[model samples]
Target: MDEQLNHAPCGFLTLSEDGFILEMNQTLLKILNYSHDSLIGQHVNSILTVPARLFSQFYFFPLVKLEQRVEEMYISLEAGNGEEIPVLINALLRKVNERTVLECIIIPMRKRNEFENELLLAKKETEAALKAKHKAITELETTLKKLEIQKQELLELNQQNQKYKIETQKELELARIIQETSLTDPINNDKVQMEVFYNASGELSGDIYGIYQIDQNRYGIILLDVMGHGISSALITMTLHSLFQRLISAGVPVDLVMKELDSHLHKLFDNNEEARHYSTAIYLLIDTERQKIDYANAGHPPALWQDPNGTQYELSSTAPPLGTFEGVVFKTNTFTYKKGGRLLLYTDGVDPLISNYLAPLVRKTVSLPLFQLKQEILQCLNNEKKVDFKSDDETFILVDLK
Candidate 1:
């Protein structure tokens, strides 16, 4: 019986009430040009055209439930290669193993002359009705024309929007590349060594830092965090990068540089109320010859300093954040740092991750190497359960003064 059913004259398919294909005969697979494994357990709509799926959802299921059968239902089935095949179907709703199923026998309509004749009869009836309502027919035609024009306009607008999006994505990617390249490279020397780890939340970063050599024994280090991140802040950071290089290389005092930067920001955003922005920064001039670091902090996070004896110190902020007020005189503080000590600088993004464990981390890991210290900080952040560390751009700089 199974062999005869598989090679039957018509295609046979069994589907669940929810339109999933439960079983199908070899004849159905051959007719749809699909492999047995591909169609088994597939949804019935996967093999149905758009209109056929709509018809199955509304008329086919309702009629089967009302009468327990569907007879001579004409529908189009989509084949494996996307070809539409018109078929006449007869289905029976029955219970097998206490589960209701739809068993459909489909006959391929290769010569659709009968179907075309039926459509012609329906068209003739519609034409007779239009003759009695000529004004309504004319209004419907005009409305259809307007709808077609609107659809065409929407398609054009969508195409333009897609093109613009592609161009904008390309531009942003290029900007990100340029910003990355503009960042400072690692500084290593006999007197000091520095390493930086930075992660941007988006395509661009608002944090910028650099180490510049001022003299044979003096090196200037600056880390700045703009108001927020992304395009606008990144642009300001790039501008600051150039300005900072020039100022530090010229051996400007830390206090004077902070004052100049504050004035510059005010001048840039003075007229624009919407673009009121400020920044926090810490500038350090490390003198290996004098064994001291002259630093200035502008409402930024404190720098963590650890001596060789496992003693930790916090270099707190000395002034308000930049762009806050004009004519501000920044103060520079000096700290004596011994050889074999380490300093940690970071943006506020790192605060939430290590706020509770920073002192212990610095004290315990002070004897470890700089790279190991970085690993320790990372492990601590990973073990933290209270905060999402990556919610903002996280950047940290580790300096080993040797």
Candidate 2:
């Protein structure tokens, strides 16, 4: 598939009759500025602007179905980076492996040609309208001058917006880099092994995790999901990242850590209601020497724990999320650890129905080899069906205890 279609000059996409994308060429993914996983299982409407989607639904699909093909149908696609691209698409219905699919070849229109064509069409339409109305020459000249001035102003405004967009993108990229750096490297040693996966819906994420060695035999792990998305949430995560490092490095108790976090968030947002945001977090302190785990869950999803004997336990929420109220106290819960026991900690983005989605997977795969378990978890998360519903940042930490 890559050798034949990936390098084609024009973008290509194959979709189910219902408009779900089944296959896409590299060219289309590049043109849309989207990753394969992001678009592969999504609907055709995912890439179309609202009007373009309506056009496809009302006219494009019906015409293609009647004639078995469509050619030079102009539409605008919304790129992953939020740019709208004007395109001319040719589509045909075909059978592949006994299943019917809609195959499309999309050619992006050159900006100059698009603008010139629109201008010419508009001019012709206006001239005819003016002649029918028998308008005076002076009136027509005044209207043309006004339209030209407005067009020039619009062009200048678009240039300024484009420049600002580029600058904002660069800044967000830098902030993303900084946030990624704050994540602790995965730990693999004789005592315990850890693996992590993180996926953000956008350039900046509201989820953050860290693993810290508090002492020779004690390790502290934390995962937090801030409310909402974008710059505000990302900024809060960064601020909490620093505080989490300070508290965990000093070996703050799990319950105290949760309390301090809640307090900090309240203090941080006390004045501004609009800017106020909260976080759901879980803090775990693993004592390898004692073979025990102490954790405090602040309204986050339960952490899945499976013993060596295949028994699973859920460390459920023990307190409200941070900043939900003033001076909230947190309670610590303990779970006995055993050899070959595995623990899974994840943010809610794993699934909106968090309990139903994760519990069965953990029970079935917890006893498998670590590598296989990791693969299963990741494959489930990356499934096109699952990706279609995901709207928040997804993160998980899998711990293997020896």
Candidate 3:
């Protein structure tokens, strides 16, 4: 047992309770590069490095005192040449011949340190690579999520825009149909031959005209223009149509009809400080047997009459527009409704937008059918890529007395 302990693979030593070296084997003498005679009586701390001495005093010594053993503690010892030799130590408490001592084994750690350092470096590199890959993957996922949200928002906006366009188109078509129906078949009788032409600035117009028959001998011709365009003005035109039929059917004279119209409209629209609505109108009662026409014009354009001898007669206004005042009086004018004479009635937009360019058209086709005149005017107004109208409604009426 003594020989085996002397020549052990690792260093073996015995320490006094206060750390003086009591006995040391040849293995420990060889590892520390010391002669047995030189160190056998020395303290164990004599060969410890500064850090190892502090660690032994603080950590392993306290543990050995309490549990009486310390296992596998790494430290460095000083060699005879004053070099630090890394080692691992394990110690156990013992009592020999009534003397307290510590038995310790020392292991050289050069080969073990190299293997553990390589392992530690490999672990650090792997962790760094994993962190970088994780960051890159997270950023890519965030970008993809944002792109998907943007695409969805654009799709929804496009869908909503398409729906609005369809709804607006439907409304325009409905307004056009109602307007055309209201002006249909105003004249078709033996006593009068009439040609009517009407055009709107856009989807709706403020212009309205029609002929009402009072009896076989007497008939009323009417034209009205509201102040503005679109649905609001178109509504006022229909309201005026209703008022005309009611007042005229009640046997009201042309002047009294104007007075009643002004009073009613002013009461409804002009009661406030500012008047809201008004219109210009021409209403005429023609007697075929007497060949006389009695007319009341409310702030309208003058009627033009061209005789067979090429002379022009102007039938101008007789009163201010309706809805302007409550108690305004209206006058009546009369003219002879001669045979073979031509009467032209129009809104203000006609001469500015159409008649100037279409004068030669009418002059050349003067002897043609009256319906052709209405057709020629429509052809010019319906030409695409053209902007004849600025903002107003246009109406042209040509009445040839048969």
Identify the leading candidate in terms of TM-score. 2
Clashes of 3: 0
Q: After superposition, how far is residue 235 of candidate 1 from its true place, in Å?
A: 0.4
Candidate 1 residues lying further than 4 Å off, grouped into runs, are 1-137, 382-390
Q: Of the candidates numbered 1 and 3, which has the greater TM-score value?
A: 1
Which portions of model 2 show Cα errors greater than 4 Å? 1-136, 384-387
Q: Which candidate has the highest lDDT of all?
A: 2
What are the lDDT figures for the candidates, one per model? 0.80, 0.82, 0.73
Q: What TM-score goes with each of the models?
A: 0.64, 0.65, 0.55
**Candidate 3 lDDT by residue in tens digits, 267-309:** 5453234426788888777788898888888888876665554
Put the candidates in lDDT order, highest first: 2, 1, 3
Q: Considering TM-score, which of the candidate structures 2 and 3 is the better prediction for this target?
A: 2
Q: How many clashes (backbone N, Cα, C below 3 Å) per candidate?
A: 0, 0, 0
Per-residue lDDT of 30 in model 1: 88
Over the stretch 1-402, how does candidate 2's per-residue lDDT look in tens digits? 777788798999999988999989998899888999988888998999755664576456766787888766667899998788988788999889999999999988655455555556657756775876677777777767755765675587578557656755775686678778878988889999988898888998999999998889999999999998776688788778889899999999899888888988888766556557899999999999999999999999988898887788888898899989886879999877888998899987885565656778878876577768778887887784554864779899999989
Q: Candidate 2 at residue 293, lDDT?
A: 95
Q: Estimate, for each residue in 61-86, the C-alpha lDDT of model 1 and write its tens digit.
A: 76689899987666889899978898
